[model samples]
Target: MQPYGDVDSTLRAIAGRAEGFGRHAIGGLHGALYLVTSLSDDGPGSLREGCRRQEPLWIVFEVSGTIHLSSYLSVSSNKTVDGRGQRVKLTGKGLRLKECENIIICNLEFEGGRGHDVDGIQIKPNSRNIWIDRCSLRDYDDGLIDITRQSTDITVSRCYFAQHDKTMLIGADPTHVGDRCIRVTIHHCFFDGTNQRQPRLRFGKVHLYNNYTRNWKVYAICASVEAQIYSQCNIYEAGDKKKAYEFYTEKAADKEEAKSGIIISEGDMLLNGAQPCLLTEYKESVFHPSEYYSTWTMEPATHSLREVIQLCTGWQSLCRPVDNMVMN
Candidate 1:
């Protein structure tokens, strides 16, 4: 089987065996299974109701359909919205996690979200220990994912983000210095021809590794407002006719001043483009090697980033089960 074929088969098999497979095993998190049986706006068995309940729960969609949300779904702590084994999409509005902890969101699709604060997923204000995995997000009004207001310990992995402007924003406002404590890990994701701000960071320790990026319009990664970013072992492929500016950009309040932003890049492969402006020479100050933000170590990527990301990204057709089980 081909690479994507293998991934599709494995994902389908896992989804078919257990609707809530791997929901409890993420980052050692354990929760009760809550089945979502309706595509309704509210009431029992709806996704909104499942998220409304303040408990440690794994919310699983038993049906394959689109849920056009009337408003942003506010998710509480200790919850996992798992859309495995089903084709579930959230349109019109997105999910919001504020002051929450220990959350897992996986195998979902978010698109065409418009209007005020219309992001794919908005993590706001003190939210921690979040894992957003294997999802597809695009065409949102604002950002695909915005981690702001001191959110920390977040990981976005094996996801696909495409055809969107302002894909990700870490730390809402540049003046909000409270974001210094934010720590995020982005791995094995695919950023495909995103216009700009694949992520514009501010005052956070962000680790971006083993990701694949292609044809970025403006820039790939921007470190601003004293962000400490370590981008390592990633692959970048520029599109024909498009000038791929050195992948990294610095946006400091005072570019002339010393020690504005800290960015460390190692072993990143650039194809059909020139090497990015080395962060070491651009920034006056950088983070110390001894800084301990995450337990995960920064290591060299073993496999081809192109192959790995192609197999793991976007919405797989295998997610739509043959039975189309609807729990009601």
Candidate 2:
């Protein structure tokens, strides 16, 4: 409770504990700190071996380089991959967490992930109680982050997602009704110049709060397949195209009677764009503009989102500073 009272306190707590900040709900993650001393694919000091071990570990990097993973790095449960105090860039296949629990990934950079299933981080089915914080992801072949197959109780905060066509996907497929179990919290992230899907959800409950969005080529936040999204106190600055929010169904057309995908917006500020067109429950597939759902109302943000997000979002300065900070 010491850190949960305010924004500064919360950030300080997250920095002090790294990925261990949210470990209490899953019975607390206690592990050894495994230092990554090599950039090799596999060895004693390599990240591959560190994550491949069966026990819980806090994987910290000592060296700085780009690690091109030959295959997806399967991480076990109760693990924390902390990339602070080093410049660690991951390319190639990236990371995959399947059926794991109580995982933490923070302060890393992922780019140039190509080939099949080249996501920056893919959380597969039945994984729960995961935290991804303060990482930078871009230019992946598939998606920056994919949470699918009923992954739940996940928090993605203070991360930067940029320069990718497909950014984040919550549900695996439109017809995977099991995805209704997904519950994710995305807060204090920066979606900069992303094409679309930041993220596109399906059959899930996603809470997006206090994030910054700029120059989105396609629609910013999307909901499909009966996904319910609660967006609060976010800043959206659209460039020359697209609105801030959109609703669509995979199997149903815009004119169809299917009423899927719901968005509840509160205290959000949209700039350089028109008001978002909300969906209606009428015959022409258009919802009334003033339609309101009385589920919840977010309290006003205590601090300036633009000011606080700039310091918190993205990979904070490594041991040495990197010039990858993009400011709009």
Candidate 3:
């Protein structure tokens, strides 16, 4: 009935089914259905072929297996890679969402990505109106997901991230002041026992809520170079690093301003010696989701939140039983 309804929702879902800044995203809702009949890296029936097409396509898998990409699968605009009723995984290079718009990727697994600058989903250089939901990502050479170079209006919801360093990076680096327009929403995700960058932000507006981040090697969240993060109702289970949030100073490119990020923590559960620095004492300008979006699922953070994320997050099977009588 609604968009981005909590976890296990259709990724970017069925038109009008995304939450947060990417609520307006519609990924090939009216496009022709393109069946991925093969698991090859590239072919007529392969996933890569459908993705590279110019026209809008709703890509679905007729067969299920691992697709080992030799190179990045660059997706075009108005595309929805819907992995429902099947199991699909990417093993080699990952999906590249470079300067595309109105794209949705859901119900896929990503792991074992090698090489430099390789990410599970890389959205950059002004890509907008994107949603990545219900995916399992880990063990990559670079970040699981990265949004940089002024990319904005994206949402990463109901995903499971683990067993990786540098989980997610918001901005490219401290130099690009144009990253100030970046806006993203992360909700109802499980950040289970990952390293830093759950994610690390540079300059952008981030609305993080209802997430479970636990047993992190580095800090759970970081703010650098004038980032604004609004963290709410999140469960942070501390590990060796008790401090869940970290703030560091970095010069903004060539500017002399020693600008760092600011995080506003509200109704959060900081367990297992999570330091109080998370409740940033002196605050500047912060972006609240209510100020922009009117409708979104808001649930209080509780210990039960763990079970919700663990169960509802990641890829799922949405297949229906066949009626044999219909064939007769």
Candidate 4:
């Protein structure tokens, strides 16, 4: 059979087999499967079937144009979505996985959704061992990447986020909560919240490293009572001078509740002259220490403040400071 013919046949076979409940295995030679297009008229059975597989599977989408999904893409464990060339524009919720394990999403673009709480990607429940790599997301109301509840062992790398209300949001699932402590690794991502939406975050043992952010007066990074946050190598620049005050420290709790918990470490963070990035108590922990009650200059190594403001304000109105006071 011809190459296209074989691909078509394999996809059809997988789809037909996956529709049923019992375990089904389809085998093809190493080079037999190639160049599957999700935007084809048949509705992306090649990719979807790979997602439904119970065993290890590698599915590649050559995004010639855009692939729109009516609902969310629920990918289970042992599955991979690789956008070879195509830009997968998820007009709806994009990708949502609940209670799944060991799934991977890579090399895709997620457009904003119309729904109230639309997110680029959402991992929930006991879902663990997930990786989101080299993805671009924009214009979502809630956040670009969201990991919640007991979801653990997630690694997000080399992703670009901008033109959204909120770039990244992490939290514990309020329902069916667990104490396992979601451990996530975020590295080398770009966050720009130019639209001024609030950034929301509450996660356990999260590592935020080497990220560049802009204009996010609401929050460059936020941690809730449920989070043991660790951060380094991040750069955040404030948009408005007054809004910088909101971007600085733990807000919305009693003095004792806010202090003595979160561990925020060294980073090249930029702030407007009006807002200081340190609290009175945590001044000793700053990587580049600043004097108390003194105005400091922000370095240009950070991203543009306007873009970050849009991302923090336009994406999702979730993580805002409860009080307007800056401790320092």
Candidate numbers, best lDDT first, in rank order? 3, 2, 1, 4
User: Per-prediction TM-score, please?
Assistant: 0.81, 0.82, 0.93, 0.66
lDDT tens readout by residue for model 4, 93-144: 6788778765556567788665766678877767776767567788776767
In order, candidate lDDTs are 0.72, 0.74, 0.86, 0.51
Root-mean-square deviation of Cα positions for candidate 4 versus the true structure, in angstroms = 14.7
- Give Cα distance to truth, residue 218, candidate 3, Å: 0.9
Distance from true location, Cα of 254 in model 3, Å: 5.3
Measured on C-alpha atoms, candidate 1 has an lDDT of 0.72
Which digits, one per residue and each the tens of the lDDT, describe model 2 over residues 1-328?
0112331232123322322213332211355667899998888899989888878666778898899988899888877787777878999878898988877787899989999778999999899888887899999999999999988878787889988998999998765778888877777788989989988998887877778887888788998877778777788878987488888866433234554588877678887763664643322332222232222223354446666676667787745222232323
**Residue-level lDDT tens digits of model 3 in 46-156:** 999999999888788889899999999999999989887789999888999988999989889999999999899899888999999889999999999999999999999
Clashes of each: 0, 2, 2, 28
Residue 104 of model 1 has an lDDT of 75
Q: Which ranking of candidates, highest TM-score first?
A: 3, 2, 1, 4
| Candidate 3 regions with alpha-carbon error over 4 angstroms | 1-13, 278-284, 320-328
Q: Please say which candidate is ahead in TM-score: 2 or 4.
A: 2
Winner by lDDT between candidate 4 and candidate 1? 1
Candidate 3 positional error at 110, Å: 0.4
Each candidate: RMSD: 6.0, 7.7, 3.8, 14.7
Clashing pairs in 1: none
Better of 2 and 3 by TM-score: 3
